[model samples]
Target: MSKPRSLSLAAYRVLSWGVRNGTDKPYIPRPEGELIWIHIASQDRQRVVEGFCQRLRQSRPNLSVLLTAPPQADLIRWDASSHPLVNLPSEQTGAAREFLDHWRPDLGLWVGGGLMPNVITRAEERGLPLILIEAEIDIHVARGARWLPDITRYTFDCFQTILATSPETVRHIRRLGVPASKVDTAPPLHVSPNPSPWPEDELIEMTHALSSRPVWLATWVQDKEFISVLSAHRQAMRMLPRLALILHVADMSETEPLHRRLLSMDLRCVNWDDGGTIEDTTQVILTSDPENLGLWYRLSPVAFMSSSLERGSGGRDPLTATALGSAVIHGPFVHRHQQLYDQLNRAGAARLVRTATELGDAVVELLAPDEAARMALAGWEIVSEGAPQTDHLIEIVQDSLDQRGQDHAST
Candidate 1:
């Protein structure tokens, strides 16, 4: 790659220097292994970055991902075990150099709704293999530097590849002097994990056990939302007597209490978590394990993403159920996964219910084979929208990491 034009970086560096401020991230010692350092250029694009990382890890289980974002920090942090997110280092030259020296990544992913000239150039100086994903035509330059001449083209040179969001973006990148070969269109990394495979025997057994019963899953249910879910089930049952609810408790400790409450409701309950099978008259099948959700997602054509009807539940992720072709019913309190829910709702992939009656209505409506299939297909389209692009990005990362590993081994 040709050297990035300085674009008055010297003046910009001097102007923005020497203030220990918001961009100061905690000193998270870099983990020992092959690590991909991702700069989430914008918070809105973080979900796509996460979805990409999740799919990438499936191919490389022990791969470490260090996600970084600007100091405003709407991007969700990963758990400590996985690798927590931190602020992107200050754009000042010194901080940029220090950050690169500290966390020498195997590959650098520039999640490009924006760009950070200083750090990106620094990464290039350090010979990091950089790839920009979700490249938008409108370049988002860092604040306080719009007065500076547009160095966007020079910055673009630092990347090994740029995956543009559209043909327009691809054209724009070329207009900015990026080589056509290095810029190609790809879809945004929309939310959804790669669909996990369930045991064929188990799926077949669950199918035969239900004898083609109309099933809906109510998963990640909190205690406060428990009765509302059950009430919704009872109300929906009035319309379809054969409907069954796979009720999963978010907290395992609440499992027994919830089970007792179900029995008190005069609902026939079976503990699927304890190897219980659904009886012919069973109205509810209970589970507490999150792993079991995969099986249930496959079994049920419709699912209620629980814990939202009650305040402070913050909502659960609906992507997994949607990824498995399950039409979703969610409540209004979806602040945690708001973007995802909004997209699903907008696409008619998910229905939002504020009350038991509404939920019951949604369940009944989605249960109609055509309605359920339509909703599920809509959800699936959203879930799998960027799949081919995601695969291409994954391949590039994998091949680069492998080559980096080989180079290190030889040295």
Candidate 2:
């Protein structure tokens, strides 16, 4: 009812542009079966959706599903082109409502980890057996919600099932008055999309064609972390003559500035956007798309989750790298993804550093075949632990839907 906030406006414009110019996404086709709608609104939402889909597809591969997320890509990215996903418009009322009205999914799954109030209320009115998965509640966000306490309470109440990432969050929401019966505390899902079509032949060819030397990925790099990455690159090249670096920024627009930085490093740089490659002597490849990181992750043996070099970044996610069978290295500042990093590191799946020098050293050390293999195996095991959670989610959803059918029969 009020004017859209700046974040809402920006997200609206991006989603609007994408939906307008975007080719029509084929509506998920299923008749006479239950439908699922997953609303994602946070940076980690993609992982949740992927995990949900992965689990649902396993026992019931033909189940119809729709995945939607916010348009803030640098923070969270959801590309529907290759999967059963749709980019939900962010204005929060008109487009979101229209999407729901059309599908009228039998069961609605809202990972409102970052949802706006209007979107939450709209789904609530439909009484579609809503499940709020991995809901988050922290002090900073609670303070913001204080300005609209009633709306926040109402949103939490909308869910028939409220699954949270931790006991603390579950307690926080209960303090806000959501019934305890509606809540479940569990570890959030951590699934990353596997690169499809193998890309194996091309991947191997890309590796060999790019460099026979050791390659390390500086993934999801942003402005705050670029200078340090460049400096590390220059310093790293001096000792490891055959080492190659891949700089994949969070935003593509950062590519030009990254190239300029490369010029001063005295290293031959290749730009993926410019259709470039690593020559026999090439030192770095600047890739500027977040989507392509999946491919690069599969290609590289060791990767440094970028954005961790800066103080406020909290950190780039290590789960993605772990899921792809690469040894993950992150800075000590991964607070946003603290739980995931903790799980992986505790499982011997990842390593952490406090500075660029330390990160550089770790990168070189992790490239060793024996060390890399050991880390890779651990990383895979960590990711595999998520399968059980995924299984539990599907069982719960199916049982709830079945119970609803039984209630109707009794009535």
Candidate 3:
């Protein structure tokens, strides 16, 4: 390394250390409600943390959650009403101490990797009950060794319970001196189901109006995949003339053009934004409002998750459809959610289709009442499997807080 650059880096670190330990303390009063501190390293895990917080709050209404993440995380995507978001402190003891002193969290839940050894060890020393969820042990251990020699063992030992997402991670943690009993393998955390925003009365009325008609939804369809969706619909329509489709375009601007194209094909359609009602002859329901997806997912017996037909889309999450009781069909390009899709496929909850013809065939097969019902049941099971892990973590947090309260009283 260049001498000048090395000197500059050292000076910057010294200045940061001085500021952290400075006498001028930042004024941050503790909240009246019980606080739980959650540290996440990246925004990719935002959905998991958000779901955990929501479930946690439902069980303990008075509990306040403080989510700490690096500045690069997508903070804006999270709902501020659910929890207060804060930037993570530098990995220095002085900074960590200052943050813990101000927040005074009753418990700590560290999610994902990038463990800050100094902060974690300090919190453990301060009697904080710490739990690590979905720990990436190998990555954390390597990173820790790079900067803080031999700190990995001490930090991994601090967690009261460590939930590793894979057997490999469990092996790594155990090798780092964490007791085998303290660590266990678990599936990755799943996002909590968001309630359907559509009104119940409307849903019931729509259900009656459609009256046993075979229905399918093409969710979040990009313009490039319109041909595939429409072709699949047309092919399926040849066999079941009464089949209805809910075409939800990803872009609102494409809604008008899509409506025109459907008209050009002489297919009867309804525009959701224009308050058009579904009639017996309506073949398609055109919409661009993403919020209304819950309604379609609930109504449709089968759904083809779009954005995966073309390359670079990485596909949208199919779990939402599965959670809402829809049998899923998608294209092969789902690298973004490959693990999820693979699990669903193995569980018989989802099907992969490479071409529009295959998509049509899959839809037709799943349209059968027995087949659709079977897949829907499997999908529901996959979605519900994560509840046990979430509940267990919540119970641990509640127990820790109860113990802390008793200790305070005795003291």
Query: Using lDDT as the measure, which candidate wins?
Result: 1
In model 3, which regions exceed 4 Å deviation? 1-35, 40-50, 61-90, 93-106, 112-114, 125-127, 134-150, 163-200, 401-411
TM-score of each: 0.88, 0.60, 0.76
Rank by TM-score, highest first.
Answer: 1, 3, 2
lDDT of 1 by residue, 1-411 (tens): 336457466666666565335545556888887889988877766667777788888999988888888746665642112556888755666777777888888899988665777787778877788998888754444567767765677678788889977898798889888788899887777665776799999899889889978999998888888778888899999999999999999899988887887888799998888888788898899999888889999989999998888889778878888999899998889787788899999999999989998999889999999999999889888887778878877899999888878877888
Please give, for residues 1-411, the per-residue lDDT of candidate 3 as tens digits.
001223322333343352253543354556787899998876677666777787888888899888888624545344223567777665554676778888988889988888876567668878888999889863332222355434566677888889988898899889877789999987777765545467999899989989989999998899999998889999999889899999999889999988998899998998988899989899999999877888889999999999899997788878779988999999999876676788899999999999999998898999999999999999999888778878888898899888878887898
**Relative to the unseen true structure, what is the C-alpha lDDT of residue 42 in candidate 1, on a scale of 0 to 100?**
70
User: How high is the lDDT of residue 206 in model 3?
Assistant: 83
- The residue-level lDDT of candidate 2 at 47 comes to 57
Q: Write the per-residue lDDT of candidate 2 for residues 1-411, one digit (tens) a residue.
A: 222243533333244331222453544553456667777666555655765675576556666777776644443333332345566554435655666677777677777566555555566676567788778762112222334335556667777888898888889899888899999788877564343444677777887775558888888787888767766766676677788888887878878877987777676888987888568887788888766777788778999887777787678657667778899988778777777788789988788877767777787788888999999999898777667778788897887677766766787
Better of 2 and 3 by TM-score: 3
Pick the winner on lDDT between candidates 1 and 2: 1
* Model 3 RMSD, rounded to 1 decimal: 7.2
